[model samples]
Target: MVVAEVPKLASAAEYFFKMGVEGKRFRPTVILLMASALNVNISKPAPEGVVDMFSTELRTRLQSIAEITEMIHVASLLHDDVLDDADTRRGIGSLNLVMGNKISVLAGDFLLSRACITLASLKNTEVVSLIATAVEHLVTGETMQMSSSAEQRRSMDYYLQKTYYKTASLISNSCKSIALLTGQTAEVAMLAYEYGKNLGLAFQLIDDVLDFTGTSSSLGKGSLSDIRHGIVTAPILYAMEEFPELQSVVDRGLDNPHNVDLALEYLGKSHGIQRTRELAAKHASLASAAIDSFPENNDEDVQRSRRALIELTHRVINRTK
Candidate 1:
């Protein structure tokens, strides 16, 4: 493990921030790709006096945003692990499990603090606001998940709204930030947001499906972890729709080990997984369509990035982990 150089919390925070365990790094990739895709010279610059809007300085700032997004993502992971009492992440023991909840929580806060400092360094009020709001959405989503009644959980709308806040908000906002930094037109910025939002939703939906179909070794965590924690995800929600009796099991809570098995049985019998995958595919298509709407650019880099973004949607839907 590469230990972090944090002043006080280095030992604890290192588990996530510096541990060599790498995640997909999906958010940063999308942000950087958005930067490239929107860098076409046709759009008017947001600021005056710059011949090259996407100049070196601006590129550096975009890189910072990518780093900041990753920091926020890791911090959320740390905090979520504490909240979920999770014991594994990235195929390794979770930070909370290794360092205790107090340290893990503090480490997450530390990462957020650093991310905020970097965000402030950008000195763009609108970008700051967008990212800050994303953080708020994260908290709000987690709270909703923790406090929702069984009735609320049964509603697909409620689940999707919560999903947006928890998963899609950060990605969508960060992509918007990228476009805004490049001074892309308002329409293009919105397209970037749409791309990120749909992609994020698709990504999460696949993750939810993987929870049921993936193995512990492949998923880097135990299969069915969400249901084990009584977190009703898309598959369960769809399964409940078909097997109404499953709603009673969820209503009574999955704390009973038997209920957990019974719930899995119902899910296996229903087309929940298939429906969830279809929904994911639908969102992935929307994401691709959003990229298709971007103003056509002759720049080879822009075209390549655009194609990659569309291809990324396919990758997100088909990924097993």
Candidate 2:
């Protein structure tokens, strides 16, 4: 369904959409799992004249929602690669690198328009509102990073807030949407949102750690690229806590090759990587607790789903790429 939405233009847009189709598809997978778990009691009969919980219609709608989530995520990646001037994504040449910025940006816009169309077709106002808010958060987060003041860039609180907007908002809201579609209570939906939010934070924290520790080949992109781009990620932020001298280097825009080397040296010597791992672990724990806190029900399927979600939290913290 997602691939069909992309026009068969004899241009780079088709390539961009094909590349998107080959992604890990992590966002949609999570949505499907959450939907399955939330609606575990499918054996229960619906009220007369109503669709059954496990009916073909319900499953089709859920699949459409999953596709919508993936479309939005891929659209974001397309725009991000252009903004960051990223050369590679998911181990392949970026659309901007292959097609130039104008086409890439327009392709991204095209994908977004398709996603919005799908969202409207769902005809669920609450789900539409949640996803619209996620889009707003994504833009706000990117703007915050691009336009951050010097003092604001150094603040941990500011960094985490930006992280939430950039990484967590989509997953959190999508999880809530899944719960809402199941007609779950407000409290249960919030719990689903909380779980996704913490998991996303942990995922991004690990990604930052990998930036410093993983190889370019392993990461599928240039290592130390964030600092090279004049962006200070979590490791750099924590390293500055121990080596205050690095601030001057950061303030200098890290334009000098020598300063970049010195910054990397400081980060390696400091506890930055370890501390970042600790913080990620903390969020992972919170995510697990969120799943565990879901009200205990006699449905065995629900119990299994909760356990799977908890295990996913661990995987988020421990992923290498």
Give all candidates' CA lDDT scores.
0.88, 0.82
Measured with C-alpha atoms, the lDDT of residue 97 in candidate 2 is 88
lDDT for predicted candidate 2 compared with the true structure = 0.82
- List residue ranges in candidate 1 displaced over 4 A: 1-8, 40-54
Q: Top model by lDDT, which number?
A: 1
Q: Give candidate 1's whole-model lDDT.
A: 0.88
For residues 1-321, write the lDDT of model 2, one tens digit per residue: 434443542355456556553367777777877876785433344678886645656666677777777777777887999999888986789888888888888877777777899889888999999999999999999999899988887889999999999999999999999888888899989988998899899999999999888898878889887788777889999999999988888887776778899999999899999999999999999988877777776677777777778888888888887
Clashing pairs in 1: none
Clashes of 2: 0
Off by over 4 Å in 2: 3-17, 20-22, 40-54
TM-score of each: 0.93, 0.91
- The residue pairs that clash in candidate 2, if any, are none
